[model samples]
Structures are given as C-alpha cells and as structure tokens.
Target chain A: MRIERNGAIAALHGHCRVEDAETLAALLWEGSVTTLDLSGCDSLHGAVVQAILAFQPSVVGSPGDEFLKQHLVPALARRATAD
Target chain B: MIDELLAQFLIEGREQALEAGADLAALQRGPADPARLDRCFRAVHTLKGSADLLGLTPMGRVLHAAEDVLGRLRGGQGEGGDFSVLLEVADQVERWLDDLDTVGVLPESASAASQALIARLAGDGAAPQVAAADDWDGASAFPGRAGVAIRYRPRADGYFAGDDPIAIIKAVPDLAQLRVSLAEPVADPALYDPFRCTLVIEALSTAALPAVETALRLVRDQVALATLRAAEAFAPAGVEVETARRTLRIDAARVDQLADLSDQLVVAKGGLIELAAQAERGGDGQALGQALRAKQAELDRLVAALHTTVGQARMTPLAPLLGRFPRLVREIAATLGKPAALEIEGGEVEVDKAVVDGLFEPLLHLLRNALDHGVERPEARTAAGKPAQALVRLSARTVGDQAVIEVVDDGAGVDPARVRDRAVARGLIDATSAEAMSDAALVDLIFLPGFSTAETVSSVSGRGVGMDAVRAAVTRLGGRVEIDSRPGLGTTVRLALPIRMVLAKLLVVESAGERFGLPLDGVAEIARVPADRIFPIRAGRAFVLRDEVVPLVDLAQALGAEAGPSSDRVVVAGVGGEPVGFAVDAVVERIDAVVRPMAGLLAGARGVSGSTLTADGSVMLVLDLAELLA
Candidate 1:
C-alpha cells in the first residue's frame, strides 16, 4: 500500500512491510517497474528487501533510516550493478 | 593512502568469515536447522555486500554463490556436499582478506579461484533433496540481546488456515529485530504464488519464555523458543564471554606512540631520582633532597600506572588467531583418515598483539605434529582401549604473567626408546650416551635440530622444520617451550609466553667501564667468588656453584672489549639448561626498561638482542645470553 507506481518508476514511502511485497513483485514481474525511489522510506520488511533483490531494480535517492540506507540500500544496489 | 572504510571492512570481513565458517561446520556435523542455515546466509550476505561496496568482484562472486546454496539448503533442498564447498569458499575468502590486508589488493589469481569455487558450489547445488529438520539451540544469533528468541516457520498452508504469521509475532511483548525470509528460494517471480506462505520469521522479545510460548500457542508446533541468558548474550556458541568492557578501535601506531611517550616519562622519572641522590650528597640540601625524593616517589607511582594502562592498550584477545584452527584440524583429520575433534579453551584470554601475531606459526606447527604423529590410527586407538575418535585439545590459560598454551592429544605418546634409537642412528649422539640418557632427556632430543621420530616423511608435518623451529620461534618472542609425554598416554606441548613484551626487567652491569643490561629472568644468581675459588679450564675459567662446575666467560672479552680491572663478580645464568658464569667488574642496580630490538645495521648483530635507554640517556645493549653462549 505504501508503493505508488508511475509508469516504469515505483516510489516507496513511510514504513514498508510484508503486505507490500506481493504488489512490488507483481509490478516487477510485469516488466514495468525498472527504478525504485526509496527516498521517503524509513523501514523495510525482509520480504520487501527480497523483492528488490530478486527483480534487480535500479535504486535512487536514499532511505531515511540509517541501517536501511547504509546496509540494505548498498546490498540492494549491488544486485542491480551485478546484473 | 588506506581508506578508513576499507580498514573497517577488513576487520569486519575477517569476523564474518570466522562466524560463517563456524556455523557451516556446525551445520555439517548433524541434523539440519533452517535457522542456523539462515544465520550462515546472513553472514555471507553481509560479506558480499561489503565486498561489492569495495569493488571486490571476485570475493563477491564466490560469496554470492555461497548465499544461493545456503538459500537452497534453507528451502530443504541441499546435499551434504554443498556444506563442504561453502566452507572452502569461506576459507578462500579469509585468505583473500589476508592478502588484501597485506598488499591492499587481492591476489591476481583471486578471480580464477573464485570461479573454480563457484563452479563447485553450483555443481553441489544441482542435486537437492529434503534435509531433515533439527532443533536450533544456538542463541548466538541474538547477540547482545536477552530474552526469548522465537523462530516461527509457519505451515505453507497457514495463509489459507487464517493464520497471520506476522500478526502473531507482532503481538508478542517487547518485540525487537524481526527478520523475515523465504523458507525456500523463489524460483521465478512470474510463477510465485503470493497467497502460499513460505516464510521463516525470527524475532526476539523481552517477554519471558512461557509468556512468549503462550502468545504463540496457536502455532506452537511450528515455533521454537529459547532463552537467551543475559550474561552470555554476546558470546559465540562455545566461547566463554568475559566481563563486557567498552572498547574503541585505534590505530596500532597511535598505541605505539603512547607507549613510547610513557617510556620517555619513565626515563625522566629515573633522572629525577638520580637528581635527588645528588641533592642529598650536598652539605646543606638534605631537606630539599627529602622533598625531591617524596615527589619522585609520587611520580614513580604515576608512571607505573601509565605504563600498565599502555600495556593493556596493546592487548588483543587470542580468539581471532585461535578461531581458524578448528576448521584446519577438521580438514587435516579428514585428509589423514583419522577421526579427531579439537576443543579450544581460553581463547578469550588477551595478550600483547606481538605475542598473538608471533604465536600463529608455532601453534600451527604443533597442531600439525599432534595430528600427524601423536594421534594413532582409529583401529590402533581402539586396540589400545581408547575411544575410536581421537581428541586433540588446544587450550590457553593465564598463569601469573604468562599465557600458557597447550596442544594435547589423547593417543599414543612419544616412545623415548624410539627417540634414543633415532638419535643414535642420526649420529646426534653416541650409543653409549643414548643408553645413559634418562627417558626425559631422550624425549628432549626431539627438540634438537634435524630430529624427526616419524619413520616416513608425511606431507602434513615432516617438511624438515620440527619442534626445534617451534622453540626458536618462541624464544624470539621471549618465551619458552616444554614437552611432557607418557609412554601410552598422549603428549602435551606447553608454550609459556609472556603476556606483555614491551616491558622488561634488566640487571645493569658494568664491564670495562661500559654499562650493559642482562635480562633478569636469565640471570640465575650473582656471587662474589674469591680469586682462589676460580681455576683455569681448557677453554674457559671454571667455578663451583652449589657443587656443580659452571664455566665462566669474561663479559668484556665476550663482547670483544678490553678486560675489566676486577673479575670478582660472577653472574650465573642458565643458557641451554646449563649454568654459565659471566665475569663482570660490578653488578649495578636493577631497573625496569623497554628494550627495542636492533634494527638497521645492527639487526644481524650477534650476542646483542636489543638496546634500552639508561637513566643518563645512554643506549645500553641488552645481551642475548643464549646467543652469547652459542
């Protein structure tokens, strides 16, 4: 519910949870969402992190939470670069 | 220039490597636990993330492959071979980290090694099956957190059964650090069923175990609970946690600078004491000298405290060095077809970094000797009424100011008769001398150069370096090695090393109008032998000390200096286990000093180990008694 899709870009806001994973995955699977903006996000569930890992989405901006920005963001970004 | 981030990464990378390796070894030992597999996955994932950040593509590739295999194993679809491949990857990553530390770059062959390991891991991942589920008892995953740890793996059909796994965990009291992951790898997002629950959720709560258990009563069968004791919350699975101390990481060079400043302060304080002595000698300055002496006493106490603090700053725990031995022991045992286990104790004991760094090679050699020669074959062990599986214990403990490390094996011990015979055959000693030697003396011959009791040279240990090398390496660190063996029982090799290497007690002596220092530990006794008590020997002067003939060497002549005017003072020191007397002009006062090893042109200087600053700011050479005798 925290994800707003605009064409090829999906902007995530506030705290993202397990419920948001299915929608993110569906959008990623549809070959529409290529870039994710985590600028406003403060926390992420492990499932949401997994979705980003699997789809290898290009990430822009940064998370508000230090752990997410420093640890999770780099981990997620690495997958995209690796692909 | 070394990047601060890169240095931090190296420290963390080594820690994660050890963590992952230990977890993988545990997983390979018995029934599979998904939670344990998940812990291993996270450790590898962290390393890969850091490697990627540092642009270490080769290390990242290997870790990524390892993560995939662990994911599959967590999904109940992995074989036993996958664990070994992952362990190898962990070791390879550790070696790469070491290379990166020394050269600030990975080796050129890292890419090839990574590719080979990835291929092996991929091959092992091809054959998958349902792994048996075992209870996860490790509370180490929730480090520094005390409470009930909940590992909830909801049934795959639980979503249809109206069970919300996330809501169930969220209702627990004082929830903290919730982690969710796929119980199995998502094969394809296109075919993924969103409604089918395939998640493993783990969390910690401050609530009591019973309260948490009651909260998860509806899904009790799927949840595992464990109490994380507060005192040991930060320790690994088997390591004993010492009292927690707040620590800050500082560059080792900065610590050395602080120690050097402290040494200068000590010398200045010594100068003040000497000034007070001069003041007391003046006719009308007795009261002034008393006040000066009082201030000097206070300064002495302060300087002593500062020295102790600086010494503690240089202390590093032995865990980092000792952690890798268990895996090494396992691999060697497998290679030799000898089933053995290594139990390490007192790894938390802290010692000077120099001692810790210097101990690795000698300890590795001793461990190899234990595995290769001391431990008997499985059938041979059984025949001797011992357990089929050999146990090799590597333990460390602090006794007074020394760190005593022992590598012991529960197998056939050294046969002194065999050793004596080997010595005779090798021409190290004559048959008559060998027969006259006691069992203890014969066993000591193993430490002699070119000595090996193994009839055939094995690839594991007998590459020419033996216990003699171990002794030499330890001696360079100002430590000693002792060995004790029983005929049928096993052997114990003890390495008693000084906890602090910076500070030393030296006995100042004057010979030929020049002052020198002798290590106080080496000097057995000092006596004023009469001129008649000493007699001329074939090569040197001989004197009787406690009914034993001790050969005396003139200190000045030994150092190529002119003879001293007086030779009455005899300093008896035990070199190579025999008393040798050094004749000097006079024995000066003993003082605590820091000795810096000879460097530059004097690095290869014989008979002089190091130099220390005297109270008068003069460089006094600290003699190496063993080297002098040799």
Candidate 2:
C-alpha cells in the first residue's frame, strides 16, 4: 500500500517499512520504475533505505521526514548526480 | 636513546595532530584558507615521517593516507571527500599517541584500526566491514570507526519467531548509519526460501556501549557489538587530550617581558640591601628608611608586572577548545539527521587556560542540546516559514574583563509552558508556583536538577545529566550562565566568565561569625536598611531599595548555618536579571585574592564556588550567591 507505481514513476507514501521493500525493489529491478517520488514519505525503514541505496534509482520529491529529507535524500541525490 | 626519542615524538606528534585537526576544521568551514590547507598537509606529512621513524607502521600507514588526501585537497581535487573521515584519522592518530605514552606501544588492534581508517581516507567507499558485505563473517566484524558497530544476523526462523530485524535495528538509539545485505547468496533461484530471513543488518550507533548492548539484548547471540577506539567513546564526558593538552606554548615576547621584570626585581633587592646596611651602621636613619620604602615600592611594582606577565603566559586562544566542536557538531547533526551548520566566531579571543579547559564539557553539552532539542526537523522548519537547514552559531567575545561565549540556534525556541508543565510533573515545583512564575522563570526551570523535557531519553543529550550540569560546570569556572528564549524565534545561552582565574576581587563578609568571600564583580552594591524599612514578603523577607523591592536571603541560613540576629547590611547581587539581597553580619573590606577551586572532599559542596586564603592564613569559602539563591 505504501508504494504506488504509475507508468515509470513509483510514488511512496506514509511510512515505508520492511514489507514494502520487496515490492519497491521488485518494481525497480524490473527496469520499469525510473523515478521515485517520496514527497509523502513520513519515514523509511532501514530495509527501505537499503533498497533505494542498492537500486540507484533517480529520486524525486523530498520526504517530509527530517532524516530522510536531510540525510537519505541528499545521499541519494548525490549518487544520482554523480552518475 | 630510544626512550628520549619516544618522549619527544609523543610531544611533537600531539602538537602536529592538534595543528592538523584545527586546520582541517577551519577548511571545512568554507572559503578554504590556502595557508591552513598547506599547513595541515605539512603537519600530516611531518607526523607520517615521525611515525615511520618510530617504526609505528600502523600509524604511519594511516597518516600517509591522510597526507595523500590532504595532498588532493591542496591540489584543488577531491572536493567531494568527507572531512569527518579525515578528522577521524587525526583523532585515531592522537589516540594511538596516547596509547604509546601510557603503554609504550600501540595496542595489537592498531593494525586493524589503521586499515579501517586508511580505507575511509582512501575514498574507496568500502571500509573493511562497513560496506563490503562479502567479507563479513558471522563473527569478527570489528568496528570500522568510532562508536559501536553492530552486526545482526537474525536466524533463518526469525520471521516465525516474530522477530523484525529491521525494526530492531531501527530502535537503536542514535543510529548514525545502517547497511543491509543478504547473509548468504542463494545458489539457485529455485531453492530460495520465501519465508526465510537471511538479512544481515549492520549499523553504526553513536550511543554509548551499554545502551547499544541493551538495545540488542534480545538478539544477543545473533548480534555482535564492537566499540571502536574513539576519543568520545573513551572520554565520554570531557574534552580529549588534543584540545585540553596541559603543555602551553607561550610567545617569546611574553617570556622576555617576564625576564625583564625579574631583572628589575633583582636590582630593587640590591637597593634594599644597601639601605639595610646603612640603617645598621646608624647613619642617617631617616634617609635609610626613605630609601627602604622606595625600594619596597619598586619591588611591589616589579612583582605586579611579573604577575601580569605570568597570567599572559597562561592565556590561550579559544580556538583549540572551540575548533573541535565543528566536527562534533557535524557528527551529531548527521547522527540526528538534522540539517544544521555551526558558525564559530571569536576563536582568536584569548582566555586563561583554566577557563578554556573547564569550558569544553559545558559547551559540548550546550551544542548537543541545541541540535537535539532546539533545532526542528527540516519538514517542521520549512512548514514554519524557515530554512530547512538550521543555523547554530558558537561565538565568543570579551565584555569588559569577562569573556562572553554564546551558543545561538535558529531553531524552535523552547516553549516555557511545556517547561512549566514538565517541572510540575517532575515535582520540581508546585502547580500554583509554576503558574505564578514568569515565562523567563519558567524557561529557567530547565536548569533545575532532575528536570528534562525530552520525551524520550536520546543518547545525544539525555544521559541523566541535563542543563543543570552545564550550569554547575560554568559556575565552577567563576562564570554565570543565562538563557533567553523567544518562543518560536530562537534560543541563546550565554556564559559570562572571568578572563583570568588567577586573581579575583572579592568582597569579604561575615555570616554567623564566620567570614566568606563573594565575587565582587557579581555584587551590585551594598546598602544598610533599617528594620522598619524591611518587611515580610511571601515566605521570606524583602526590603525596598531605591523603590525596588529586592528579596532578602540570609547568608547564614542559605549556607545551612544557624543564623545570628539579622544585620542591617544588605549585599545586593543580580540573579537572572533580578536583584537579590543577602543579609550578612557585617560588610568587611574588599580585597584582591586568588581563589583556588575547591578540591578533595569539598569539591561538590553546595553554595561554595571555591576557597581563598586570607592574609591571616585562614581559608575563606567563596559563596556563589546565584547558586545559593537558585
């Protein structure tokens, strides 16, 4: 329920936990989801952060959670920019 | 020969480490000073040379990697490199020196520690056990850096046992970094078990060792906690040796001035000796006495100059103490996931070494509190029409003879109402008194012992001691701390400390037939009020002084001594912007004395700042009226 895929963009909402990591990873692994919109994300579990780190997807929209917005989002953005 | 060389190496190594660390911190603060960068590079290079000379291979390896990184930094390359890792390398080297000084050799773990540090400095993105999951065994995942490194490999049946590995790792206090990977690669896709939990969770927590251990207690067998040899982890509560080094480097000019004063004193002594011989010969006694008086005056002048020169030699710039905070601030901010930047000013301002040394713990606590409780999260900050990145300024400046240090944060200023509620809930004050207290007084309640507004105890700042400890430490340094909060605007905590601790002007007063010294700077004025002018106010008493009713506290009663008849002498002192009068037996003469901080069993005695010996050789306890009234 936390991950909604529409076309090539997948939007994550609320708190993304370990259970959503599999769906999110599968969506990214299938080579269809190119962008992740995290504007509505309140927080992310460790597994969720790890999946994002591993997949190296293009991230868009800042999360509402301070940790994700300040640390995780910037990290993801840095990698994307580097690529 | 080797012992002497080792001693010299330890001293020089510590100096180079401090120099490099401070310069690196300065460079990280932007507009990178080329001179500082070059100096840092050279310092590291020198340290590397010494390490090699001493055959400290592990230290040499780490320093060589650091030197290379600094080399890149100097060449205007590798701008993306993390300065915190470099700072860690410097800290690790300093810790090794400490070990070498104490144990005569680096610990056996130094090699492994150096490798981890070298990997971090190499910018390889793969520290031994940090990111390289392939090499991780179920056991032996030593900490790659400071703080507690944890490896959690939940059993395959962990899912069935209702164990949530991710949640367990998430619950760790002050979790700085987390990495997840598969425990074992699946040989075949067909053989993969859907319900099996093969997740390996590795995390670095800034929490203390016991806290991490307790968090992983349930999965103790499946978890491994390795505490890295970190400066903070080892010291935990005070400044590290690099910042609080006892050895002082005084300017040659000051030493020359001191030598001149000593030479003048010697000449003055010769004059006195000639006058003494003239008196003994019974030749013109009056002229001999006049000559002796003149000689004594000259000696006094020379001694005063000498005393001042020595105090100047003891003066140390605030940079060494304040420089280390930027890296620590970054670490704490990263750990808390807060977007905060620390701007330091007046690092060049000089203060007595004692003041600088005693200030580190309190300043660190204040910064921690600012990041942990003062700064709002990015979302919250943005919603409040503020910048996502919070700004905390650590500044110092001289005000008159006092050094004023301030920690100002543009974050969610403390809510006095919430503080009042917490104070009442914690039984620090009655509900009626809390409601009657002013907003400023309500905010000041945060400094009351055992008072904390933190909803949950975070490892960052909520480790039993609260703002009260900060207040105590500052007061112990002959300083007074004040906090000003503007609801949602911001908060500023200011500490006004004496520039020098060697000499203090104290107003001697007698209470209960025993004499005490009160810092004259804190004493506003002395007044004598007739009994008719004093009237009972609230539970105590007050007197009208120039149309202002200042509350009165009997000195004897405040110090737990039996009160004699209340005298008319009232000494008014400022406490949190209000005048409070202390009635003592009599107003004695003011004298300039050196007040030594109390030690031994009397160190923690309440209401006493320090002790000073009187001209009669009697020890007088200096009363901290502000603390006593509080």
Candidate 3:
C-alpha cells in the first residue's frame, strides 16, 4: 500500500489487497478532500473498493484494468458526485 | 454515540450472520431452493454493505468473503459442504466487531483470519467456468438444460459504485454460459483505457431471471436476462422466486416496553376500581357509579386483550434453539466417542424468547450429561441387548400455557441402589432412610446438590455442578424440572416452564387477613373436606385424596404471619409427581393479575416469587409454589 498527498487530495497508489484496506481507510479518513487514483494499480480487493465507495473521493486517474475502470471507476465517481 | 451504534450493529450483524449459516444448513438438507439461498445471500450482502458504510474495514473483508461463499453456493457449488466454516467466520467477525467497538480497531489476527476464510470459500477444487455459447446452434455447453440468457452492460464506472460485476456474475445461482463482447471498437495497446470496463456481457444461465436480477440488484438495469426458447420449451422447471416472508423482526426492547406498559396499566386500573367501589359506597350519583362500573369493565377487557397481544409478540418459535441441537449433539458425540443420535420433536413450538434463552444452559448441561454418562459405549450397549447407537431425544410442546420440554436418552439408566449408597455415604441422607426409600425416591436423590456418580470427574460434567444446578435454574424461571429413571432402561428429564411473563392466573388465599396468591398453574385442585378427612402423619398432617397421600401445611404458619382459624380449604400444589396441600383460611376467587417480579432485598427471599396489587389497594405476594413445597 502506498499513500501520496498533493495539497488537499490524498492519492492512493499500488495494489490494495485485503491487507491494505484498513491502512487505506485510515489515510483517507485522516486526510481532507481526498481523491483516489486507480491508474497505477493492478487490482483492488473488495475491501479497498468498499473504502473507495465509502470515502467517495474524486478520481483523478483510472486503472488500466477494464473491469476496474468501466465498473468500479463509474461506481466510485457516481458516489463522489452524489455525496 | 458512534460506539453505541457500532455496538448495536455488532449485535444485529452477529445474529444475521448466524442466521445465514443456519439458512445454508437448511439448503444442504433439501433440493435446490433459489429463494432460500437468495435470502441467505442477501444477509451476507447487507452485513458487508453495512460494514463498508460504517468504515469497518475488518468486518467488511470478513463479510465480503462470506458473501463470496454464498455467491458460489448460489452458483450450486459446495452444495453439501459443511457450513461450520461459515459459522466460524461469522463468529470471528463478531469477535473482531466487539474489538472494534471497544478499542476502535481490530486485532492483529483479523486480516489473517479473514484471508484464510476467503481462501477456503474460493478453494472448492475448481469453480465451474461456463463457456460462451452464442446463437444456441448445434453445439452447446449445457446441452438440454433450460437457462435464461442475460445481456449485461454495467455502468461505465460501476467499480466506483461499489459494484463488482465479476463477483455478481459469479454469484448467479446456476450459470450455464458466458459470452463477453467489447462494446467499443478495438484501440491500440498504447492508447487502451484499461481503467474503464467497456464490455457488453451476455450470459446463458440455468438460474431464474429473478435470481440473476437479485444477484445484480445494485446494477439491475445493466442486465437483460431472458429464458432461452429451446430450453424453456423442453424443461418447465422455471424457478419463480417466492417472496413469502414468514417472520418480522422486532427489537426486543420494544416488545419488553409494550409488555411492561401493559403490566403497569393493569396495576393502575386497580386504582380506578378502588375509586368506583368508593363511589358505590358513597351512594351519591348512582347513575355515575353505574357508568363508572361499565367503563371499568370495558377497560378490564381491553387491558386483558392488550396483555395477551403483547405476550404473543414476545413469543418466538423454538426452531432456532432446536436447529442448533443437531450440530451440538454431533460435536459432543464425536468428542465423547459416543455413538448417539439426536431426535427432536415439536421444534415448531413457540414460547417466550426469554424462556428459550434461559433454557439453553440447562438443556446444554443435560445434553452433555447424556452424552457423557447416560449414553453407554457401543459395545456395552450391544452386550446389554440394546441398539449399538444410543438415541437422545429432545422434544418441546406447549401443554396449555406451559412448554413441557423433555430430554430422553436410551442409555444405561441410573441405578437407584447406587444413588442411595452415594446419598448415604455423602451424608445427604441417613443410612436408615436410604435403606427404607423406594426406588423412585432413591433416584430423586440424584437431584440433591454435591452429588456425582463419575468415578473420576470428567471434564464434561465436572464443572462443579450437577443436576441440582439445572433444577435451580429452572426453578428460578418459575419452572419445574422432574427426573425419572428406570434401573436399566433410561432417564428422562422434563422441564415445564410458563410461556409468558405478563399475566399470571392466581388463586388468592388469605392468612390472618393478609392475602397470598398461589399460581394456578401449579395448583392441582382445591379441596374442601371435613375435619374427619384430616389424619395426623409423621411430617405434619396427611390427607388421602382419591388414594393419593398428600402432606399438608398451614399457610399462616408457613408465611410467618399470625395464626388464623382452622382452615378447611386446601390448595393442593404439584411437586413433581406428588401433591402437597397448603391449608389456608379462605379460598378466594381465581383471577388474572400482572405479577411484578421481586426486586432488591425481596429478590432473595424464599417462597415469594413476585407480588401483585389487589383490588383493595394492598399488595398480595405470589408464593413460589415449587419453592414453598420444596
């Protein structure tokens, strides 16, 4: 798991498996106005996806994986807008 | 406040999680049931969603894995697999949930445990992969089986919506085939948008559309499922989802609140009756007094009806408690190396949830005792001309307002001679009385405290308790536990418990102008006999009622009140198979009253279970019949 901050947004990087879910949640919770970047990731576990869905952060980038981008990215973006 | 909400979540989530496991066990016992399976699936999904929304990462991971297992189960995989793993996972989630609620974080082992369970759910040898079958031409993966075809175009960024299309697709109860087509034209590898899913998916599934739609409920609009013409024409096993819901869950606090209010209403209504009586005596406004009497009657009827309604709401079917016995007996039998089979009867009997919950420990103790000492070794049983496998029967049925639960084991029965010898040796009973006791009385001595027949205290029943403890618990709940044994046949323990707590039928009796209420459930009969019928016995006084000898006691003396006139009325109460009579000054009318439980110092007082307000404003103490007789 990797966490990077750029001003108000905290961008998540690397493959976030079940083990990384808690840490990812902690970083997002601790930071304000955070956004998720899935462009550099390989796969996101259900927990990570849950974290994204719950946090509802703006997506500055998208993952290369078709399933992640088309399904997960839109799901996350809709929530971010709705919230 | 967050901690409290999390605590409530933990409690509800844990219950739902266990129910999910029970649902799977039901599925394993029957043919394919898409509806029941879906119900189980929904439970896990709700738990997972709640955990994620609450930012409970550890809980989310655990439930997500359980959800996956349910999905595969919906796919008709691991149909006959033991659901112990699911229960264990749910139990672990509860433990971690408790940790999270208390310490605001999960323990170190949470993630590892979740990962392990996830792997187990996914480790079912090979997950059946349905090959894409298009056009339904001459070749088909699932030749003759009828299936619905689904065209799924998930939201462009469904992953962000917390939608896992792949997981949903895998969850379809019965998947026959899958064909994926890219919705857009192919782009160069360098310019490919890997983050976006642009697939137009189509699938032929043996599962019903309702099952598929429910599985993809979050993305219901994305999936278009239809029955294949050929398969539908040949096979008519079209599964129609049944939304027949049986039970509605109500918070226990709410039910208790209603019952408590009804009880208070009953007490308050008594004050109104007293006012009406005063009005009648005053002889002013006779018409108003008549109207007050009519209104009081109506209020009494409504109050009684409301009390009954609240009591029914507090009642829950005994299925859940009985459902756990199969697994319990199996595990206990295995551990004890005893070949015992558990046979349950009348599990559909419903009773107060509090009563059922209170029964768990005592029933568990009896079951363990049956397995440990009651059930004999297979070889020993065969030699004794009995079946090799011992049978343990647990049954519950409502006998009037009481639930009579019995546990019977077909094993080596208790030896009365041994019990008599043990009682004498333990100084519980003198040798002379032990020698003079009948076989049944000797066996009854086993219920005495500090009694154990085990040569070496076994771990199962060696918890420094005995049948006496079981009896004590049952007595505390205003129930009776009776033990019966035949020297070589078997032992049967019957627990008869009241079904509710609201209204108790009491037979009011007076002692020195003070009234006492005796619960009518335990009263066998009220007898009036002349002085000639009474005979002097060694204990006190004895009377023969239809050839049965009953010992009698004076209610005034027993209650430590002032002595009253010689009473002719005898309120005979049941004490196991025997009847004991309490002579009171007068036998008043039988009426229903809301018995208030004794609290504070009175809680520990013997022979008084509760008290009820009389119509005359004074309190009438309800005697604990069993305790008084004991």
* Candidate number achieving the greatest DockQ relative to the actual structure: 1
lDDT of candidate 1? 0.75
Give me the displacement of residue B214 in model 2, in angstroms: 29
Per-residue CA lDDT of model 1 for B1-630, tens digit only, reads: 136547756776787787787677556543576545755775786687567657799998989888777766765674543365576688778888999999999999889767756765666333211110133432555754666667787877776676767667767776655655557776977898765677776777888654786798787667655455454323333331222122344458767767776777777678777676777677457767676777677777767877776767778888767875776677678878999999999998988876876676678778878988999999999999999899999999999999999999987889999999898999999999888898988998898866888887564665444687677667756677889998779999999988988768788888989889999999998988888999999977898988999998889989888888866898989999888999999887676666889999998898999997653345799999899767
Which rank order by DockQ, best down to worst?
A: 1, 3, 2
| Model 1 lDDT, residue B315, Cα | 87
Find the 10 residues in a row with the least total lDDT in model 1 chain B.
B126-135
Quick one: ranking by TM-score, best first? 2, 1, 3
For residues B603-622, what per-residue lDDT tens digits would candidate 2 score against the true structure?
98887999976643457999
lDDT of each: 0.75, 0.76, 0.67
Q: What share of the true interface contacts does each candidate keep?
A: 0.10, 0.08, 0.02
Off by over 4 Å in 3: A1-83, B1-97, B100-301, B502-630
DockQ-based class of model 1: incorrect
Give the least accurate 10-residue stretch of model 2 chain B, judged by summed lDDT: B232-241
Interface RMSD of 3: 12.4
On residues B1-630, what C-alpha lDDT tens digit does candidate 3 reach at each position?
A: 445446545665666665564554444334577655655765666567557646677678867777766666666776554343455465566567678768877787677556655554555433211111112221132244455656666666765566655567656766665544455543443343333555555566767544665776766545544343343332122222222223344558767777776776777678677777877687568776687777677677768877666667778877766765676677668767888899999888988766775576578778878888888988999999999889999999989989999999988888888888888888999999788888988888877866877666553453334677677667646577888887568889999988875557788888778778889899999899667899999869989898988888888877777768886888898877678988888876676666888999899888999987653335779998678656
Structural similarity of chain A in candidate 1, as TM-score: 0.89
